[model samples]
Target: MLVLGLQGSPRRKSNTFILLDRFLQEARTKGCQTFMLEVCRKQILPCKELVICEKNGECPLLDDMHDQIYTLLRRADVVVMATPIFFYNVPAQLKALIDRTQTLWARKYRLALTDPKRSFRKGFVLAQGATRGKNLFEGLQLTTKYFFDAIGATPAGNLYYWKIEKPGDMAAHPTFSEDVRKAAADLLDPLVRRRRVLFVDRDGAGLAPMAWAFCQIHAGDRIDADFAGIAPAGTLRPFLETAMTAKGIDMGFFRPQSINELAPSFSPQQVVALGADVMETVASRFEKDPVEMTCWELPTFDTQDSEQISRLCKAIEEKVQESFGMA
Candidate 1:
């Protein structure tokens, strides 16, 4: 999983930085790939308070956060925000970044579109304050909750400290490091987004399409299932189409699609290659290199065998759920 940390401290070598650094170290040890963006060092302008995002789900501003952070948010499985309370709230730099996520909010609410990985993503907060007030982190908590919701992540946990003034004040707290380590373990436990699985076959003719449609019918809510071809055949054979119709699954509009035809950013988290030499082709397209991809070579049945079609679909469906850990 990708754990992205946004450091919101304006002061260099501050206490906030020390806490965030320690948390990231624990995340790395837990097998998560980590990224840290110093918000104070970045040129993020304030929100113009424009509602263009409500209509088009886009920010018209020509700023650093317009396109960059959106990509990071889409790729991350966990997000970590680390900042010192600067007057019972987060820093202005961090606030601007959070405000820019309105575009993401619009996409989810107005556009009614969902990211496939959104369901499994998580978020966390780490805050410190110089005063020991009950409401010291109240405002910060609400802001973090809404920001995490906008990015489609659940508010997993937090590490908030009071009466922490100097650069290394958190080190003085007896349980601070232990708390941060526990939070890191919860946030980066899985260490990979393994919800979306793609199935590949010889041509999208029989087995691939059947498995894709069956899984969508049975376990679509818990998994994002799709299928493509190593060698697309434009359309399914008439026999295959008829067989799917008998099973009450629609193959009428089903046409063969090549993996290369998908969007540039589309890379399935799990891959099932049902033929030999398919991983080599899929691996060349991504650096993940098919870690979740496995080949399942099986007997190919003649298109004329109607019962064989049902059997093939059932087998692939069972394996899809088992291999990908689908719910």
Candidate 2:
């Protein structure tokens, strides 16, 4: 699992950064990969209001956002926005990032496309204010809710503090560390509890992607599913995309990767090989633990036939359900 933290404080060692650092470190201890983005340091342009995203789901302003941040937002399993309350809201830097997510919003609502990982993604807010106002976090909270919605992530948890303005203040607080630890556990335990399943196919263009997509739709919360190929094709087959779209699943941002590319990072508890050729490669590469491996002999058919494509997808979905105990 990847936990991405957007540190919104301008100062290097400010209270907001301190809290975010500790929180992300706790997440790392809980067996998650963590990436921190210093939003202030990056050149994130504010929304130009050109309405280009609504028209075509593309942002005109070219900067780090266009270069890298948008892809990070989509790939993140958990997004943590950390900032000090600036006039009861987040700082301008972080707000720019939020506003630019309109591209994602337009893609989902206007274009009717969906990110494959959206259903299982989560968002969290960690904020603090100088004064203890009753509604200190209200504006930020509402903004975060809409932001999470735009990015297709559920608002999972929040940790807000007040009257902690100075540097080292949060670190000095008696309960800050404990609070962050507990919050990290509360947010991550359920996801960590789910079993990790990896689906392998020969070319990654057909059956493996279908199984992975359906598993994401049907058993995403219960199974942490990943798919790859022993020899990846340049892209997914057209009929596979067509079949998935028929089921209302938009195969947005799908990439084909070889087993060697993913095996170093992902450790699956269960491995399902859709082809016999890849099983030996998978078993040889994942020689660490005794991962439960099974092979399914799916019917091979012409990729151009729509009926054959639909039938293949159905069989793959059924195998996915049965293998993951979703049946």
Candidate 3:
């Protein structure tokens, strides 16, 4: 799984950073690819309240945060936001990032864009405080809850430590290591042990996302399906979004991602290529793995005909059923 950690502490090597690093390290040890974003260091512009996101479902600001962090949040299977309790709340830098997620919220709420990936992704918080107050983490928790919602993650859980002020104080906490390990295991065990997983190797814009949606509908909870491309287009194809809407699968928040970004997160018992090109790509990359790889010939966007899309969807559904041992 790809775990994105947001380090909210301003001080370099602070207690919050130490705790988050431990958690991410444990996640990596459990075979998860991890990334950490230092909020204080990044040039994340605070939300200007432009309201463009609410209107058109896109943030107007064009900066590092929009270009980098937005994509990271979309790609991660799990997101971790770590902060030091500041005046009974999170740090200013972290809060600014959280505020900017209002754009995502507007997209989902106003535009009715349902991100299928959100159904499976999880979010967590790691917090540390200098004093042990009964409500020390309350404000942070509320902010994180809404923030997670904005980013399409379910609030999975959090790790909060109190009375830790020194730079290396977290390292000395007796249960710190154990807590981190357990947290990682708890987050990964269910995902890793899934009975079935599906991988797609195109831009995940049209064929891949549509195929994933079909599997979700037909197989229900019996299988877990995921989609990624080798060289992602960074957004879904407009026509595919319209086509999927006809089948009742909302595709508004779909984002393209590379197979390299997703490979570490999932171990698919079977990998299905949407086309011949995809098959060749996966074969070259995962030739040594024992996983079964197959190809389904789906028409490309060049066809652009509804009849062809319907035929391809039918073919994809048939193959998916066969792969799941249901056919």
> lDDT of each model, Cα atoms only?
0.74, 0.85, 0.79
List clash counts for every candidate, in order: 2, 0, 1
lDDT of 3 at 206: 72
**Tens digit of per-residue lDDT, candidate 1, span 1-327:** 467889999989888888888898897776566788888998788888889988866788876775367767765667899999998899999999999888888877876655444656778899999999899999998899999998888888888898999877877778888888887876565543335667777676666766666665565445555677877896776776666655545453346667776423345676777777676776665554554766787667776777876776667767766764563
Q: Which candidate comes out best when scored by lDDT?
A: 2
- For model 1, name the residue pairs that clash: 1-191, 1-192
Indicate the residue-level lDDT of 214 in model 3.
69
As for candidate 2, its clashing pairs are: none
Q: Rank the candidates by lDDT, best first.
A: 2, 3, 1
Taking all chains together, each candidate's TM-score versus the true structure is: 0.66, 0.87, 0.85
Which has the higher lDDT value, candidate number 1 or candidate number 2? 2
Q: TM-score of the candidate numbered 2?
A: 0.87
State model 2's lDDT.
0.85
Q: Work out candidate 2's RMSD over C-alphas.
A: 2.7
lDDT (Cα, tens digit) per residue for candidate 3, span 1-327? 468999999999899888899988888776666899999998878899999989977887887667788877866778999999989888898888888889778867887766655777789888989998778888887888889998889998988998999888988999998998898789767764555566685676777877776675565345566778878896888777767665545565557767786776676677878889879988887788778887887555454688877676677778777767767
Q: Candidate 1: count the clashes.
A: 2
Compute the lDDT for candidate 3.
0.79
